[model samples]
Target: MAQCRFSSSLLLRLRSARRFSSLPNPTTTQNDAELVSNILLHHHNPFHAMESSLQLHGITLSPDLLHHTLLRLKHNSKIALALFHYAKSLPSPPPLTSHAFHLLIDIVAKVRQYDVAWQLILEMDRHNLTPTAATFLILIRRLIASGLTRQAVRAFDDIETFVLTRPTAQDFCSLLDTLCKYGYVKVAAEVFNKRKHDYVADVKMYTVLVYGWCKIGRFDMAERFLRDMIERGIEPNVVTYNVFLDGICRKASLHPQDRFERTIRNALKVFDEMSSRGIEPDVTSFSILLHVYSRAHKPQLSLDKLKEMRERGICPTVATYTSVVKCLCSCGRLEEAEDLLGEMVRNGVSPSAATYNCFFKEYRGRKDSESALKLYRKMKEDRLFAPSVHTYNILVGMFLQLNRVEIVREIWDDMKESGAGPDLDSYTMLIHGLCEKQKWREACQFFVEMIEKGLLPQKVTFETLYRGLIQSDMLRTWRRLKKKLDEESVTFGSEFQNYHLKPYRR
Candidate 1:
């Protein structure tokens, strides 16, 4: 009887333990669903609940899960493995919805995965999810980046026909940007022409198109676009003013004497219009205009713009001071240029290679070899090795001008030691200097050395050598050069041949 009682007690204890084990632990699953829902809705922190849930569920989250998680998290990766897996795992994968497809397209486009983006779009269409204007815009941007402008337009036409909804202003702006980037400014203008009735082109679109025209040297077209923008009630922005100013600066820098006056007038007109529109000029706008005026020898106007910049609370950049210095130098105002350089240093604007080079060039032009050498030494002290061929050539010219043959040789050797070999200009300067000193034999020997070093002497070299020989009345040398010219079949223009033969005839 006692054994039966003990057995019954044991059975009752076993049942109690089993029941306790089977009961859900409140803390384990405690409000987990609520936590997940709250995370999905309220908390944007990607680190919340989802990863923990996956761990708790003992499920290894694949790339697809991570990708969808990231998309939900809004982080962009170059290759979205999660998205790829998500697309692969869907049973009867729904057509790529426009929104999701566009997001993927943009991500891929930014990463330059054109092929993958195109494939995704094709798969989306296969799933019958029609693309939208945004879809086409993303493709257009990618195509332009890939240098496929023609294909971009064809895609745009397809989107227009099938997407039903009219393209937005943003869409037109993107198309314009693509066309402008690819040197198809005319095609970009055509896009604006067709869409003019639908959506008025904004300042950004017009600016891009104008800049594109400027890039292709179509300044007239760029001006017309600027006028069109104003006529269409689109006020130009700082970017517009900056681009216009830059275009003027480029033209003036290239052809200062011939086109300077007209370009400066047009630039000032834009600046005045900018002021009338209550748009304050930024540092870039001020700098470009200052450069244009300075190059045109209009220092007073450049100074006035500088004052205007200061009044507007826009501090001049290093570029601004450099432009001013360059302008002053070009107009034979060296003292003023030096003062401006000193002022720049006081203003905490560090001079660049260009600034020092300008100073050196001016000094060299005045035969002030001492000052040029001082500046060159200062440039070296600043740890700025001259990278420009022009800078090196200027120093060489200065040394040659001073009859400092040893220093010229030193500079040439230094250039080669620094891994910067003599270019055609450097060779020309050296050869000319040698011949001018009545060292024809040395010049010919140097010419031979240059040829041995694989440097081709320019036509100018032959002319200089010929002139030197004739000035010395060395008929034998002239006959040798003529024979060489005939043997080489170097076609000399009538003027050059006449110039060479005149001294020989005399």
Candidate 2:
């Protein structure tokens, strides 16, 4: 059915091309007609062929047919082809109607061809086809998708000046949504503040702006927006509440000078407000509250919140348990963290890769390699084959610390066998390990391999190798590495160079 619909749409476009060609100059028309017929029968259905036919014949399709074809192609998932054909069929000193250009812009946007869309808009201006509100909206959406919010707003202003249509609430909402998506929450807030009186912003738009501000750690602006929403008699939704909660949690996490007590108090205030407003807090809300409380070293309060969740008939998710486990690990309560992991299993909440990673990191930090390796094996048994780079680095670092060079080589081989080659950090960690073990020759060989693979050694990597060579009293070898660094133009800090020079002078 889908294929039939697509083929039918293709046929309709071809018929339109035929009609367009037939009503023209005879000599040119004959070529267009043959081209159109060939396209309709061609083994490969290239939309570009029709475009080339229209251009060759100087065929200008009527605005209505162009609009209709665009809508049809869009609905049938051939929008890119439609726009290409439309651009080709557009007459020089093009039709004064905005609809043709508007439809073309929209089709280009839907296909995410922003550069071509913008070029077409520029052409529209050259042809004196004024851009409308709908035209600006299409441009705004495409720009936002491409992370060009500033350009989107400029285009919006141009739309207003050229078309004489005032921007609507939907316009402002679209702009705000775009800004928020691209991490420009402050710009979004400014736009909202200036335009709040011009258009009635909805809860969803406010929520989006608030979430954006919160995500980028602009809590002050987020609070102002919340207050503004309340002043406008717009009730906050669950999303709004989540954004506020997230803001408080993020502030607590990032602010070293701010007391955890303040974070805890702020979290409690939000929770109390939700309760007062008869908004039942979801598991995510509970998780944030737990995380903040755990960070504040209020473990009892964190655990109590979990109990509160159960009492309120809100079942905890794996995410909830994972957050708690991570909190325990952060607080150095490894036993408690492990107990929470066991509890998650008992509750049938399957452990995720994050769960294994958190526990494995904690064990490795304590030099409990056996347990960490056990968890690593369990991860593989569970079919989580791609251990993160951090995990691999940790494993390699652990073996190196224990002077287990043979095991490190085995692990490196296994990593390659699994088709997960070393990243810069991976190579650096192994090289550092080799250096610490006084395996200068092996380290130099690995460095050569890294260079051959086009991996540039980090500053610390060179420092490690240089230090190893100096300690081994291999000044000639160190000079060779120095020459390589000079050739590569790897900048060594004065402090590092001076440190190296001190030993060489001795």
Candidate 3:
């Protein structure tokens, strides 16, 4: 979906949603800019007020104005929809265009208002407006963005049923890339096989497939695709090998002790092989190598790669710096990591929250609570990036492990208020902590909330909570949790002590 970016839009320059005592009095002295000012001010107004404001202008809406206004107020879906409808309700309705519809769809769909979006599509159909590939493209992107991979796949079927029998190569690939990116590689392949005959196969298409398989850590399948592409006379490019290397690093991370040497050799062999074939490894290539070494906690190798990158005259990006910094932190080389961070700032590479997170994690590991909290506050105050949910989980778990129950409560509430989260891990850790503290009521409350949010508890969940409940004679709360587990089809194994999130895992 296209970003509205209303803050920078020229229309928002009408004036920051400052409510003047009265609407700008339209007169001969007033101009078109002021008129837009009055209309655009509705972003901060309710539907009725915005509709009233639009009527006060006493002019028919123009398609161009509608398009621009929607773009400007896209962040506020209700007001945009109100203005869109107000334009249609005029005594002499102005002509509407697909641009207006698409803009509204883009705005509403972002908030996961799929029903409203589909309704707009129906309205477009009634207006005799034919949908374009761009229309479906926006839908596919949004669907995938919301983790709706199946719906995104069905939207591809929509392209054939509603838009065209045979979508262009670009359209097909757009959907293909969307599906593959969000861990929907199998669905992507199925879509490809069903539609592959309609278009000529290309290297980019196979590259996406390779990336998809690699993303899921199926190295064998990824290599098979690489071989298949070559057999089909579609030579792999540097980008292809870069993505493959990234996959290698991710796969290696899961079994570092078992595959450390083999993975490093395999990764470098591919890197050297690319060079030998005259495919110049780009900065991304170096960053991938740095990241792989970082994942392996091979700090020296990471530095060597960093030096090699500089020797090749490839300027390191933020990602490159982050990879090496991570390696330094993970290996307990805090002094060297701090020096590198200073170097990163001196070299004008803006440190991302990820850069700071490395230090935050190291501080936590050392139980340096003061430094950890300071780093966390600095990232928030500077607005580098929102602290990720993983960071919040770490913080919560850290305080809990230290037996700082009051601080743990504060952090838990703060995460919910800040919208970072109380994800599954957060809940699990907090529950474990609360139960250990014998705060059974709070533990049960959090456990219920976790279930309400559709998160399944792990094996440790039942073993701890259930055993405690029965022995402690808290059958009331126990009944509630047991009912939830039953409703979710979670089972206590025949051993009556083991459990898992999924039945198969149990």
Candidate 4:
């Protein structure tokens, strides 16, 4: 379904391209301008193509021709900017519309060219043309995003006076949501308070405020917004309640003792209120509850909620299943976790990295190296979940524990084949494991490989190698290793020398 949606969207874009192609070119001569325009349309380096067409073929490009070309390349800001510069340099500059300026400004602002974009705005003002509200919004969003909060606030403060269009609830929400997301909840509230009267406030705007306040742990402010929404005769929807529930549960987990106990009770009260208010609890609602229980270490309650949710015909999602699996693992119910993993797969719910990691973790916790190795193989064979660095580390460690050092090389090869080869930790573990088994030759080889890759070996790694060589009475190998270390510019304290000469014993 996702692939189909992507394909459909791509087809729509191709159709749009065709429509763009059919538009009348404003250039005088059809041949030269048409070629440049076509080059801009099809060629990867349209700017270079346009220059080559001009220099090599003596093609004369007018600003009007470039203007039409700019329209085609508007989706690509970098290309549009280049084309604009090319057009602006012509003897007779094309008559660009205010709308065209807005598109240019918007594209530049998106790429964080705040200074350049602001200069364009000033130029637009010098021409006595007012920027559209969309342009101001884009600039304000960029300023706020790039840590220029004061500038953003100032711009937003003077937005109504500058931009002619009446600000809509959407503009307010866009700015407010952005402000809230970046830990500027107070600024968001201030913006809301200042602009609420200008635009007809909607449920989404109120919810944004509520979510923002809740995110910053200001439950009082969040509730005040909720009440304001209610007084304005706006019915709070499922999303609104879900925000409160998620906030409450998250806040509950932060408390330590008595406060922690009460906060959880309060979360449960919110859940009860949700049901009492006749808003059917969806997967999100249940996921929040399950997550809270998992955090609180109440796996039984999480399982019970899962069963109850199933009975209510609310199918458990991958997130819900992952949390439950984690809880089961934490509570030492490995068998139940495995059973749930099977049920999850059978029900068409693909296991995530976390789900597989849970089993790996439990097996490792129980010191069952063979079981962990089998689980690692199953995870790779399934191909549904991508093995992370932790997965490789665990499998490599398991091979070492089982005294199967020969298999370690094969696992390393497989890890590289999977495209997430050994990180520093992987090399360290492999080198340490090989040294422990007195595989001095392989250890030295891996050590050199690690150094060549620019992954500096740890002090422990050097100690392990030096100690291993000394213990095996391979003094010649130790001297060669020390010389290699010197050549690599890897420094060590004089203390290591004392240890190296001390003994060959463990």
- The candidate that wins on lDDT is 3
Estimate, for each residue in 431-506, the C-alpha lDDT of model 3 and write its tens digit: 9888887788888989888877867777787568766676677879877887776665543324333453332211
Residue 78, candidate 4: C-alpha displacement in angstroms: 10
Model 3 misplaced regions, further than 4 Å: 1-96, 99-125, 138-166, 182-200, 217-221, 227-235, 253-258, 373-386, 405-435, 438-506
Instruction: Give the per-residue lDDT of model 1 (tens digit) for 68-119.
Output: 4435433333324233444445553323446666777777766677787777
Model 1 lDDT-worst window of ten: 52-61
lDDT of 3 at 368: 86
Span of 10 residues, lowest total lDDT, candidate 4: 52-61
lDDT of 2 by residue, 1-506 (tens): 77556545544544443444245455444443343333333322364445423432433443444445444445333433543454554555224357766766777676677777777776767666766677778778777777777777787777777677788777778788878877877778777778777787789888888889888887887888888888888999767898789877865652463677677778779888888878877988888777676556665666777888889998888778877777677667888888888888888888765666677667767878777777776766877547666667778888788777876786787677776667888888888878877889899888877866767777778767877788788889878776765554443334334333344332
Looking at model 3, the pairs that clash are none
Clashing pairs in 4: none
lDDT of 4 by residue, 1-506 (tens): 77446534433432332222244454433433444445444434644634422321222344344545455665667666766666555665545567667767767777788877887776777656777667677788778877777788777656677776566778778888888888799988987888788888888998888899999999989999998998999878889988987887776654466665776688778778777878788999889988877777678888999999999999999999999998999889988998999999899999887778787777777878778767767666867688777777877887787788766777888888888878899999999989888889999999988877777778789888888788788889888876777766634344334434345575
Off by over 4 Å in 2: 1-117, 120-150, 158-171, 181-183, 215-218, 253-258, 331-335, 346-348, 384-386, 413-421, 449-455, 470-506
* Comparison by lDDT, 2 against 4, better one: 4
The C-alpha local distance difference test score for the whole of candidate 1 amounts to 0.69
RMSD of each: 19.9, 11.6, 9.9, 10.5
Candidate 1 clash total? 2
Q: Candidate 1: which stretches are off by over 4 Å?
A: 1-184, 191-202, 215-220, 230-235, 248-265, 384-387, 418-421, 438-456, 462-506
Clashing pairs for predicted structure model 2, backbone only: none
